[model samples]
Target: MSDTFDPDHLRAELLPLSTLQAPSEEAQAYQRFYGLNALGPNGATSSRIGRVEVGGYDIVTQLWVPDQPVGTLVLMHGFYDHVGLYRHVIDWALGLGLAVIACDLPGHG
Candidate 1:
């Protein structure tokens, strides 16, 4: 496919976190499915969810660490993809004692 599109404009149009309204029920359900609520007491050593400012946009980020981490793995998603789709990967990595850090790209889940 050949096309010309500018994501900069869309990124610029994003509102600040403070100015955004609360998430809807559907959004909440998705979050729950993705384990975005909080780290469960039964799983990995640690996990956290937060946001980072990038070029005037807030990008969602997450980290999962094993009790005895052998190394860190940065999990990146492709276009139109999100971390939720990699739960199995995360589980496997954690099983192998690898820490995982992931994020939701701009304009994606």
Candidate 2:
């Protein structure tokens, strides 16, 4: 991890925006700071990103699978939290050979 990791930058990227349009600049900053793409490489595993429609809204989802999985671990972010904030936990889980599945809650993050 780089010493320049900024929590503010990550928080800005994770903020819920009123507009539906994507902010390319913030997204780029997030990629650079976190060393992870929206749905690309993550440490030793490549993650899969998708969305599931429940009720009348779309919920973002992410899955990280190791080469040889021993079990599955579900990660749920707390209030005002996002998946990016749980990278360390995810890394730890991956190291333990546990596949991780995380999702953005209904209206949080």
Best by TM-score: 1
* Residue-by-residue lDDT tens digits, candidate 2, 1-109: 3324444453444433323444345544544455444331345665554555568766666677887778999999899998878877887888888888887787754
Candidate 1 structure quality by residue, lDDT tens digits, 1-109: 1122233442344443334345434444544676543332356456555566888868866677778788988998998888888887777777788888887888786
In angstroms, how far off is 109's CA in candidate 2? 3.0
Cα distance off (Å), candidate 1, residue 88: 0.6
Top candidate (lDDT): 1
The root-mean-square deviation over C-alpha atoms between each candidate and the true structure, in angstroms, is: 9.1, 7.3
lDDT of each: 0.64, 0.63
Candidate 1 runs further than 4 Å off: 1-31, 35-42
Per-model TM-score versus the true fold: 0.64, 0.62
Cα distance off (Å), candidate 2, residue 50: 0.9
Query: Ten residues in a row with the worst lDDT in model 2?
Result: 14-23
